[model samples]
Target chain A: MTRFFSLLILLAVSLPAHAAFNIFATVPEWGALAQEVGGDKVSVYTATHGLQDPHRIEAKPSLIARARTAQLVVATGADLEIGWLPLVVRESGNAAIQFGRPGYFEAARFVSMLEIPPVLDRTLGDVHAAGNPHIQTDPRNLLKVGEALARRMVELDPANATAYVANYQAFAERLRTALVRWEKQAAPLRGVPVLVQHKAFPYLQNWLGLKETGTLEPKPGLEPTSSWLAGIVAQQTAQPARMVLRAAYQHAAPSLWIAERTGIPVVVLPFTIGGTPEATNLFSLYDDTINRLLRAL
Target chain B: MRTTLTAALAAVLCFAPSADAANDAALAEIRAQVKQMKESYEQRIAALESRLADAEKTAAKAEATAVQVATAPPPAAPAAAMSAFNPEISVILQGQYKNMKDIPERGITGFWPANGHSHGDDHSAEQRGFSIDHSELVFTAGIDPYWRGNLTLGIQDNEVEVEEAWFQSLAIGHGLGLKGGRFRSGIGYLNDKHPHAWDFADAPLMYQVLFGSHASYTQDGAQLKWVAPSKLFVEIGLEAGRGSTYPGTDENANGANAGAAYVKFGGDVGVANSWLAGLSYLQTSAKDREAEFEDVNGLAAQGLFDGTTKTWIADFVWKWAPDGNPSDRNFKLQGEYFRRTEKGELDCLDEEGVGNACDPAMSGATVLSNYDTRQSGWYLQGVYQFTPNWRAGLRYDRLDSGRRDFGVNANNLLVADYRPQRATVMADYSWSEFARMRLQYAQDRSMQGVTDNQVTLQYIMSMGSHGAHKF
Candidate 1:
């Protein structure tokens, strides 16, 4: 029995040596990015899936359990996770991944934010004080955030610093090549007027130079009503948009309703990794996004 | 260069006199001009070459530093980048208009009064027509690297009360947490939650019978909780407190008067459903716990009991949302069951000595007897969110009076075999996350055979900080 116990202990200690670094990602995009940069040196646990709303997540016990064992916690800060992340971090009881620690990395801090409200008010409907946190929509932001994220990983796990750097460089090189190709393919989408279901695509619009004609939601985070849809339809009659864009997680009812009246196409974009079957990884996410938009055009 | 050429021109002009002299002077002037131009070009070339050398040196220095930065790891981010300790302050404004029967001495029938001896105006009493509920002021902030503190003050008309004040450990590793001070005990699912988070305007009958009407089982003490490192989501916690509330009286004695322990487990089922269940136990002691009761002759009297009480609670909750997006639609089902057992001694005193049924031999004297009783109750509630800003809920609760043995003091009090129950339904509409208005109706039969139909219109508005609720 003693030998058996020793054997079990040995197995437990030896198993984690290869993939010893544990990363707790608040969203699927960060988890996918971390895996791309960390390679096989880290094991990641994503707290929310692609279909789940990041802002409305509950601080479940399962998330706390995953956070307790994590060496690093990567999130899209800027109050994008203001509703749940604070509670989860506090309940985890893991000091290493607390705010301002080396193990805490926020992707939004490394990227240039957009849609900063001129005034701070809750009356604006859940407006983030730090601006829009959907930085992953633009592939170029990924390169910048990935570089900083790699440095954070190195600081937390210095033993594998070289590997982290090499991995980031490799990822940057691949993504840079893909960015050139995606830009060339999406050049025709430039200056094309489109409607959005939610205010979730500023970075995407900025990258592709797509003209945002209007939003289905009357305000940010508010559901679209029939009157709002009718207003969009009336506006489309004068300055007609070509297509309506919606995220994979959003309900397609409103976008489809607008499309039906205006005779415009409805394009669904994988807003993050694993949002669609083809968007299973970082590169495929943008590839699938551009392909859908091009098809719609 | 220009100056030198001008000097040569002036010398040539000064020497010119006759035609032959002029020709010779002009040729010499041309030759001197050419010589001056050659020296001027040499000086300009030297100056340009020196400037080019300086530019090259600076470029080399910049390139060398760039190389150094590229080879070395970047400096660590500042430790205080996100550690600005700004306290989260918030206030909750709540008011309601209630329409119900006028019953000043309202008490649950067939059960011991929960308000005990210190009762004046019950805190949960809803005056007819309109009244402002408690306005709550909350402050929470990280004290340092190791602790987080929270303070909440409840304000009513001309009165202020400290509802909760506690400090929780932040840096306690190993999935362990420690909390100290006056805070609500985590004995039942809804016990620790504030009133604003409740779906209905009123509490369940089970809770009202166990504690007091609309009262929470709070304690002033310390608690420790541990979470297991497992995929199934297991947690265990224990608390020790000075139970100076209902079901327990302040004895002013040393040591812990109340103790509680609980174990909880939860997990998600696929992508659309999640569940959590827990079992909790509480043990407390009471000295001279007082309650008003009626005798066989229907006269007013009081009963004081000294006893040890134990309670057990089991709770469960299940939530469902399509694709895990609750903004569109969601549903939650929650329920809790509790059983309590008490053993003690009861002293019955005749007030005003006007009751003839208080045992003629024991007139003007306290009737002492051995007392023991057992009681149980359960409640189930469900809340449905059909839209992003609207929710409706229904709750049903029932309590069993169980059995009571009063020994020799049985004739001094009235004991009946009765079960009290209530059914409530409410709907609330939210303008946003910070504001909500609700309308509720309830059929309450908790007061013996008297059924009171109640309706309430309520509004709750939060200002400043946004709080994330726990599941």
Candidate 2:
């Protein structure tokens, strides 16, 4: 053990400085976006995977060590990570990622948010004060954030400014063209009544023009009481939703339970990048989401 | 309306151009008056719209502010949430109901007896009844950009004692961290953790023998740690403490009487398995540490030992989880071995009226004896989390009295080599991240002559903001 530690210390001391700028993203989508925008000039480290919930995490020291060396920190922000991110960044002691710095980029700030509560109360249940932070569900919002992130990259790494601008323009154009095609293809899904697992899919519902009738989780983080589930079942009996929708990452029990009772097919969408095998990147993320919804129908 | 007026004006122009120029001037004045009225109304409407927009913006900002405050649990200071300087406060509550065949006479085998701060006085001996255990209130916040301060006050039966108070540097660069004031020493695996964080209702037998009932290596001290920049987690830490707790006393820590150093490494075995191992060394000096013993007359006497103490510890932990997610199911196996050696002088004195024997240097009647002893202990524990909210664990502990030698004394006392062992089984359920209840059963043999069959039920609850547990 002594010999191993000694060698490790020597290697750490003797290693050359890395040429790649290191970026630490709070979630996977931003990590994917960073990879797309910064092809060879950066290395990205995502703090969370698709399956793990991002609200809370075990903040290990190795994560702090990684943050300590990070040049930029891209996060969903708007308190989506309010429980863990502030503590991690504070512990990292990295001045570059401190709030108000150029390297501190919040993707939510670049996009218009939803669900800004009209009145503040604990009764609201796990609501984000800065508005709903699950903005990546909407492809339009991701494009806006992508543009902002590319500009931030240029500000942080001025030498790669032209490359970043070109990358952003190309990504923006591709997304716009895809957006028109997706909207036209998804016209059939318009006005389709859908029951949701949680409010995580409201932006997606809005994008696809689906009418969300109710949610399995009446309040965030609260288990569905049988009484609450009964009310949804009654509604489904009257109006009869075409499908029950949920994110691939969420537990399927509640959605499956509702589907079994109501005979509504349950559809699992890729909520973010890499949520499913085919949802590998930004474009594929939406493609798989639409395909899954159509398959369920 | 405008076209008719224009045609009327055109007919009048054809018929009345020969009429008076004053009539045309009067018509122009009327048109100017109508135009001015319209412009005034348009400006007033624009002003009203601007005011409405500003009101909406202000309302939205207010809602955001209110919602942010509502997100956190309400604090004593209503303005505390927005105030950047408000300290983060957290409270931990622990309660337990214990049942046992017998509670021993408050002393650990092969070690010193209770000295006020023992398991006997607080929750240990209070069996067959519900007792509020050592709960704590913690306050922490950043002192400045460069340093963060923390204080934990232990609360037990209306008595509040300072458990730990320290300040740590945030920007010490080069994988280096520096801590000052009093903090838990980086010792064996479980030494630094509080009882609230323990897997069982009580500590292991090995910890009871090595330290007091509270298995803490905390003291007034300073520590420096370094993390190697390697794929594997490698860390080295060293501490210098005022030896004012168990294993040493306040009297012994006149200077830097305690010191420790440790090296640890951890890495993943596969996608779902990981392991960590560490080696630690500690040395301290104690003056007049007291324990109970039988004199030649078979009466209880106080034995004060002054000596140099040295200890070595090795710890290992292995964890496995399905799909790298511990929420559904996981297994953890951890073990630690400790060996301690001491060279000291024991001064035995009668209770109440010791006849100046309390001061060994002042009286010849003081039974001054020189002794050298070696003792070792080890424990292994395994826990399996069957679901997100339920877990079961089993632990075994062994202690060995390695070697003992005593000098010639007036009372003529000697202790035999003996190995003591204990086993414990526990199950716990967490209602949420903030609350947990545990049921435990143990067969302890830490006492020389008695076997203790102990059962305990415990609940630990945390309220307010708390930092994440370290891995």
- Identify the candidate with maximal DockQ: 1
lDDT for each residue of candidate 2 in B81-179, tens digit (9 for 90 to 100): 666567978899888888876554655565555353233465543546788877799999888766789999988766888989999876544455667
lDDT (10s digit) by residue, model 2, range A27-58 = 88999888888887888988777766666454
- Model 2 spans > 4 angstroms off: A1-17, A60-65, A78-133, A211-214, A217-219, A222-235, B1-84, B114-120, B124-127, B251-255, B295-298, B353-364, B409-416
* True lDDT of residue A216, candidate 1: 96
User: How much lDDT does each candidate structure score?
Assistant: 0.80, 0.73
CA shift of B146, model 2, Å: 1.2
Q: Please tell me what DockQ candidate 1 reaches.
A: 0.22
Give the Cα error of residue B158 in candidate 2, in Å. 3.1
| Candidate 2 docking quality: incorrect, acceptable, medium or high | incorrect
Most lDDT-accurate candidate: 1
Please, what are the lDDT tens digits per residue for candidate 1 over residues B1-471? 212222322332243334676588788998999899767655654454454345436534543443221121232243375544568889999888899988877777777888765545636445778888889999998888888899999998789899999999887555666788999898888888888888888777778778885558888887766666567777766677888888888878766787777778888898888888999888888898988878877877788899988889999999999987777789999999999988999988876566635544546878889989899999999999998889999999899989888888787678867889999999999877789999999998888878999999999999878568888
DockQ of each: 0.22, 0.08
